[model samples]
Target: MKPNEKQVNIELTCTEIGGLWGIFIQESMNIRFLTYFMHHLQDEEIKPLTKVALEISEGRLDKIKQIFIKENFPVPRGFAEDDVNLSAPPLFHDIFSLSYIYMMNRLAMINFSYTASNNVRLDVLDFFTECIHTSTEMFGKVVKMMLSKGIYDRPPKMEYPKEIEFVQKGSFLTGIVGKKRPLNAIELSEIFFNIERNYFSVLVMLGFAQVIKDKKLKNHVIRGKTLSEQQIKFFNNLMMEEDLLGTVPVGMEVTDSTSSPFSDKLIFSMINVLNSVDISLISHAMSVSMRTDLTAQYSKIIAEVMLYSKDTFDIVVEKKWLEQPPLVTNRKKLLNSD
Candidate 1:
């Protein structure tokens, strides 16, 4: 290979290696958590299922280790002595644990799918395919459990709104002045659907925050919850214009269980902060493509939410749980100029 080609091959190999290690680490940590749950589980049916999962994970772990060894690569030290707490009380109930498992399996499948597509090595491709199959099977089991429990948390059904108005094309100065072209039902539905999806992500994150114990994190979660609620209302009103329902799925129940494998406060707080930032970024992009009036209103709402987020960040910094993100020195001037 040419020098550049050799470098590229090395980089790809390193990337694939890191990805494989990540999978191993995640699976090992999950297996540890499941093993702990197995000991504390009261339900006979669930216990067996947990045991089976644990075995499958352990088998996969062994296979990965063998692959590393065969390739003369150092195996990853996943979840060493300091990484697990065997003595800690069960942090989640059977149902919750199963749901978590299901979510993780889905994540694993996605990761493996991506890796399999990218890696040209036959051995790596085969390994990722095995991982994909394992996660798929685990996901199937969890979905079956969810079905049995009758807790499929599907979003509410919605139909197209009856009354539709054409959005008139116009310049920024003359609102709806130039051409009055009616929007089709499909176009209207797509806009509302995108809004609803955004709202749903925010609400679920909020619900998770409500039960978080850390005071700083609690504030952040609550702020996120409110932000999501406002967005939901905004979308709902927009749908009302078209006479359509814009309801998003909300988790019906939340657990206040104090026991947590990780820092509940930190996890919830991080989740809220990350999700808010993501939403803000998307909203900013959306504003560019949207009508001026719609953009202005959305920006105003986002600004308010961002203020709340800033307050929460302050709390986190005060508690010393997180380092403050870098601030722009000319933020005031930038906003004023805008």
Candidate 2:
């Protein structure tokens, strides 16, 4: 970084790796659930797909560990064998499992793109590049399987415009009062996709509420269900105002079984995954909305969720379930003591 300093054979420092939080948290989760799926899954069609993702997650985690070691950074104590109980009954239906993979990997692909783009270190770049490729392959497989099963929820259909047209008036941005313009195709796409995203959270929290045994976490998960319900309602009302169908959650797909299939730590960590992504999704919606009112709505929701996410993080901390990300040394403390 200085004129007199000469550096060679560069290795990645923690700061140089972009999106490590996402990679660490997400792959840790994948390790838990992917292992669970491999244990309880009976579907011949989806088993291989699950295994492929598991291998990638395990391999990536190992590489991340080695990098952290070489840098003398504390390797995060991510979820492990203790986080899940494979012998427990299958908590989710096989179909839901497949859909989860599809949706999660889709999210991963989005994250991997940003991670790769922002990273300067060559190995970090290469790792996320491969992440994108692996996620794409898994997403394609699950989507094909879901489509063949005839359960893939397609977005609302609209007739093509007779001709290309430009925005004719400033009213397009107004939604606070008076008749608002019909949701444009881009607006429609984002809203629908957002609802679908919340739909996953709603059902997952529901399932978590049922199976989680710890009293505090049970209450927390139940409240999370309430939060997700409110979010889904917000998105659904927008869709319904235009006569578009709202997303049907996989809540009913969860069986009425009251067994703990995963540890409280894993359940809490999964909620962390949901919390992190919800913030990002809201930010993206805010960026893409043309209507002032829609942006305001997303902002309000983001504020509420930010507080909720802090509470969620507090729970993880209280239980010491959180793993610290790599940080710089406290040299001043050492110098003061000496």
Candidate 3:
């Protein structure tokens, strides 16, 4: 942009459009949840953390709105105040909201990094870069809060390596049968984090199921909870096979409030989004894992999650809850118009 040269504006690429659209919808939903939690949160220390998170989401929504308006792109009808009930009794304890913010920010960092890396537009790139910075800050604050509360589930500690060592045996990757080499640090880290993620997933399904009144949606959430539980057990078994301590749940309690704080559509959409994120993370785990058995386990878990995600998508579509993304026009249909 210069005084002599006219500013030439380029239309957004498909990826740019998709990234902005997706973030808009997610941030809008986050704003609703954060607003509800702020209404009920009583812990003075955690209240500030929740407030920062809400501010971040609100800012993102406003920025995305500006971009959409500039491009004349239709804004998505994402979740709003009507989707959340501020007066509903607390469905989750204060600790759960803190943990939820921690997990959401972690996932946001991963997603924003990916989206930023793939796009070329200066505005879009800058937006995601700023997002990464804010989310990283929020994540650190939440972790500190969790640690101070003595509730953070730290990854397992290991003794220092005696020396720099290289693999000596062809059996380094073998683990499907007989005695195998002890789990490498990389494999162990992936297993630990994946199990931790599934714990959060289980908590979401468990809490959402209790408040959902629709029989079909309740059953689906329950099924998702069972799937998360099974994955956790499988990952824990892998750790035990190596004589390592397994991951323990964070014990974030869910209240028995049968009243739903969110609309059925919102609850269903939340679960749906959680499942989709789980699949992406599991796929990443598969890529980083080294041991044959660990890779195989990751593969199996991904397959299960993919199948479950499809079922969730089908239900969303059936219930008319799925939002359509921007798409290319059909040239053939245009040419054949009567």
The candidate that wins on lDDT is 3
By TM-score, the candidates rank as 3, 2, 1
The model with the greater lDDT, 2 or 3, is 3
Per-residue lDDT of candidate 1, residues 57-131 (tens digit): 888788778767777766766554333444555545556556556655755776678778877665566778888
Cα TM-score of candidate 2: 0.91
lDDT score, candidate 3, position 238 = 79
> lDDT by residue for model 2 over 137-237, one digit each (tens)?
88888888888877688888998999989988899899997778888888888888888887788778878888887788889888878887888898888
Q: lDDT at 128 for candidate 3? A: 91
Q: Against the correct fold, how does model 1 do in TM-score?
A: 0.55
Give candidate 1's error at residue 289 in angstroms. Answer: 12
List the candidates' TM-scores in order.
0.55, 0.91, 0.96
By lDDT rank, best first, the candidates go 3, 2, 1
Worst 10 residues of 1 by lDDT: 3-12
Q: For model 2, where is the 10-residue window of minimal lDDT? A: 4-13
The better-scoring model by TM-score among 1 and 3 is 3
